[model samples]
Target: MTCDEQTFTMKPGEFQALGTGEIAYVKPMTSDDLTTLFPQAPRMRPGLNLWVLLNADGTPIMLSDSRETALANAAEHQLHTVALH
Candidate 1:
């Protein structure tokens, strides 16, 4: 098989090649996008901070922050903190 076929054989969590974090074009994200974005959003509670991995439209791609905020955000299911470039 080709290189792609070989690489695809790896497990989900297994390390892959470069160019992994690539996405298509889209508009800026808004609060509306949050609903669909973070189905199980981690709510950032008081004294806690949640760092969001945002897309091109400012939508949170990943919902994981410091441990301090994890519990709070997870409990409340809050979608906050957009990652910086």
Candidate 2:
């Protein structure tokens, strides 16, 4: 799938539509990432444990919890998506 298009385990992983084709995977903000992401928070949807995952090719694969298992799965699969929630 393209970066703008995704199929996330049939689950709802929201995609933040950034202008200039800079689409970001919407995920729950971590303390560190949050500080940085917050500046852009106004553009994000509120209140969801989201983590945008991508493929090696930079296509959105899914959003997931920030757990090792979830990350491992994504890494094993070599998904190009980022885990944002």
Top lDDT model: 2
CA lDDT of each prediction against the hidden true structure:
0.41, 0.43
Worst 10 residues of 2 by lDDT: 16-25
Model 1 misplacement above 4 A: 1-44, 67-85
lDDT of 1 by residue, 22-56 (tens): 42112233343444567675443444333445433
Model 1: how far residue 38 lies from native, Å: 5.4
lDDT of 1: 0.41
- Model 2 gets an lDDT of 0.43
| Top-TM-score candidate index | 2
* Cα-based lDDT at residue 52, candidate 1: 43
* Per-model TM against the reference: 0.28, 0.31
Q: Report the C-alpha lDDT of model 2 over 1-85, residue by residue, as the tens digit.
A: 6789977553223332222123223334433353243344333444545554444333444445564545665556653334343
Q: List the residue pairs that clash in candidate 1.
A: 29-57, 42-73, 43-73, 43-78
